[model samples]
Target chain A: MNKSILTKREKEVFELIIENYTTTEIALKLKISEKTVRNHISNVMQKLGVKGRASAVVELLKLGELSI
Target chain B: MIKRRFIKKVLVTSAVLFAFLLMCLIPNNNVLEPTQQLEYVSSEVNKIPIYLLDSHNMLGRTNVAINSKEIDKQARELLEILIKEKGDNKLPSGFKAIIPSETVINSLTYKDGLIKVDFSSSLLDVSTENETKVIEAIVYTLTGIEGVNKIIIYVDGNILTKLPKSKINLPSTLDRSYGINRDYSITSYHDITSFNVYYLSKYNDVEYYVPVTKYVNDSRDKVEIIVEELKQGSYDNNLMSYLNYQTELEKVDYDKNEIALTFNEYIFSDADNREVLDEVISAISLSIADSYNVEEVVFNYKNEEIHKSVIKMLE
Candidate 1:
């Protein structure tokens, strides 16, 4: 998958999720609405065609879009 | 005769099909028109883009234009929004107030090209990492107004010669020369040349232009530096740049007070929306306009006119 295809905000949300931040924690840390945080997660998951947030993170890691 | 007529019909049909195919192949420039009103609505109060620092420490500008008619009121309102502690009105994701939470602008005055901004003592309580960004947020936001060039910051009627927590000394008057995106990686500070470049960042699904002032030891012209920097994309990992990574500057020419940049086709490839394209143009124009005393910026692709924007500086 093309890495540059994901937006800056999506990358930020994905990184936070990978770091084990909950949706509420991500919302608080990024200073955005909880709905917006959920939107980002769903958007990323949709883009990667993953069913769950965990699968999305796994796909991103497998694609080398995220690293430990 | 019948066969000739039938051949003519077939030729005409194929010609029409070829023409339709060609039309589909041509790139549509009209698709990039502004479809959404660029407004930041928070708490029933319409907030325009005031420059603010992101979590990764990059300056993101708002897409909304400055309300020139009521400069003072808008400035004060934006300042209030900037300093307000956690409120129902939320900032875009990954961005936060540069000014500390408890800080308040007690008074703001514009006189003789200088904006005397008096802030409450709470402004001094910023941490060390935020010391410069806080000062930048104030100066940049204030000087963005018409007729304001320099800023004199004060804490309760006293000039802030040094930051309260970090103790970083301040120049008596601060302006754009104070620079954004100050690179601490440089070893030889004197040889550094500063250039202001704009990158795109999205908040609440609306793309905003983020201006980053880069200091490099290279001595290239400011316009070339900007185009190159823009092509290199945002230094901040979390910030998105609208310019495609493959975009290449074909040529740069300065004539009759106008700076023109010719770039490759990749510049338009990533812009899926007209508003985004317009922001890309403004971001490039504003960055160049802020750094150079130029009247206009002309963007060209393949030696053909793509777009031209008049440089309207805040002051």
Candidate 2:
């Protein structure tokens, strides 16, 4: 996965979204606002030219930003 | 004949107003019939409260009702609502999401009463000042789920031990034990005891109850602490008012499934209207239910059972 395309946080959020954690659970786990989590996902999506959480995750895995 | 008609009209209007006011005072939906109460008891969905920042930037809780009985599912739904720019719950507009936008959850697991949730790293982007509030919102929201007693947070599958900006050390496992909305002003030499309590807040002139975990260094019972907090009024001015200053806790008793509180006449006499009275009942019930094992909170005035709230008994 070409991990350079996404910020560290964005990659982390993308990986988690792919893992199936909900926004609230992510916020609780990371000790940050759910808004920030979404922001990271949106940022990744914007960067990858993708739409939706699952698509971003799939693109990241393909780009080597994430893995199986 | 015209004067008689006018007098009759005035009487009818006043009677209607009286009934409306009475309806306002009584526990409207709370007094549910057995079948309707059963719906809540056997509900497939859970009503979980997610704490968010209000217009004043103080911690305010909004309950999100979801159709999933699974705790993990409920937590996810709550996260979705909490992260949204605007909450999907019935809470009024002034209440805003505390979690920064774009954050997402990776997974949530429960084992032996401990809930472990993994999230994306974007969760680290919250401002330092909101660090504690963010934790409070998360802890309060997760712990609100029954059987889920503690929380362990992770980022990208890695356990988070400290906050990024604030560097606040996190407990390996966090529960209500960590405390929410710390009452730092309380000065005592002894160790502090922390627990969750519900308080009142208003949005659009409608009163909503918010749960907060508070710390006290005193030896008072948890029930007394709840009453005392209510009497102090909400520290946040934007929140609603409750509990007359003179509303003292006359007596308190509790068993495994019930707690009874006797308050001074101020509780009844000081309630300016039914709405305020309902607020009082809710504040008391919701707060006391958090820390105590009791299922019913009985309110008494002058040694008589004035009203009883089954807050804990509710599903």
Candidate 3:
């Protein structure tokens, strides 16, 4: 709802991460490579300066960049 | 009259001697000043980046004096410096040319940011182990020249699309993306990401950087990958990383083509002095310049700015 820090693709990837979509399942659902799925997560994590995907999701929610 | 004539002669002789001495002193003063001599020398020679194989058989970059100013001529001159047979005398101590000694450049043409170099059959004389290194040395050295972004290597007028010994396929146009000192650690062929990371290597106690192009299945951003690998240190015994394993990167922030890294206090070599080792700085800046497009990197410890480095300055 606030200024979005995550890119469109990154938002989609995180939205799926919040839904508990596995990396492989997210890749299949998005019709992208599993590596690409991981890359998206990694990119967002890097922007947020967090170490893991869960932390990234938590930070995004705190920043109001994502909604569950 | 005799006395007067003698006096005149003496005066004339003295006057001539004085003039002769003045002329000699004037010439010495007219000799080129040291500053002027240095300017003349720098004008006639350029310090160009030349990537050469070091004692450990890794490509280490060193600047070599070149006399050419024209782009085409400079490219040929650098290529000559990269050839083992021709460039031996030009190389710095402990460095060797990666190109095979017998290789000969048939022709070279440069236009529109691309250089096409045709080499004779002898170019393939390199051993299988050094085949990729030879290519890397060429690509990195040539691209070091200003305005040269791409290169096309040809053997006898045919595009060299594959390495004869290693059988590694090469694109028709080669650039930094081709990577130097390639190390593959990927689990699967699919979804491979390649990034360049600089590691420190020593020759005769002198430290230099060797860039390794790592191909891994990890899909992390390049900065993250570089930091992680540098922290892991070099797998090769010859290469080393100065980054402390305990150092942790806390946050990455970007603004206006610059990236800032915030790290723990462990990043400093001497916490009391707030000092980061030069080798550590070079390793990080060089790796970041090669992998990331940012023009500057700012190093921070505990949210305080410690050092700022320009990417071009590192290169």
- Number of the top-ranking candidate, with TM-score as the measure: 3
Give the Å shift of residue A59 in candidate 2: 46
Error of 1 at B162 (Å): 1.6
lDDT of 1 at B193: 57
In candidate 2, what are the lDDT values of residues A1-68, reduced to their tens digit? 11166677776766666455788987888888999987876787798796665555545443435542
Model 2: residues with Cα > 4 Å off, grouped in runs: A1-68, B1-46, B84-92, B195-197, B269-276, B312-315
Tens-place lDDT digits, model 1, residues B1-315: 999999999999999999999999999887676976565544444345567766556766753333344556666766765674632154556566677788777888777878788989988788878777777777777767666689898899998876566454556788887766554333331234567777666756766666776655455677777777776776567555566667777898889889888887777854453222665687678888778767788888778777888765321
Flag regions of model 1 displaced more than 4 Å.
Answer: A1-68, B1-48, B55-57, B63-68, B86-95, B185-191, B255-257, B264-266, B270-276, B313-315
A1-68, model 1: which lDDT tens digit per residue? 12254678888887886565778988998999989998987888898897886566555543435533
Off by over 4 Å in 3: A1-68, B1-44, B188-191
lDDT of 2 at B21: 97
Q: Answer with 1 or 3, whichever has the higher DockQ.
A: 3
Residue-level lDDT tens digits of model 2 in B53-115: 776576766665677777787777776666756344434477777677767888988778888
Against the true structure, candidate 3 reaches a TM-score of 0.68
Interface RMSD of each: 20.5, 20.6, 17.6
Error of model 2, residue B122, in angstroms:
1.2
Instruction: Write one digit per residue (lDDT tens) for candidate 3, span B1-315.
Output: 999999999999999999999988774545555653222334688778788989987898777888889989999999998888786667888898878888889999999999999999899988888888888898998887878889999999999877768454566788898788767664432334678898988888877788898866566677888999999998799989999999888899999889999999989999999999988888998888777768799999878899999866664
Which candidate gets the maximum lDDT versus the true structure? 3
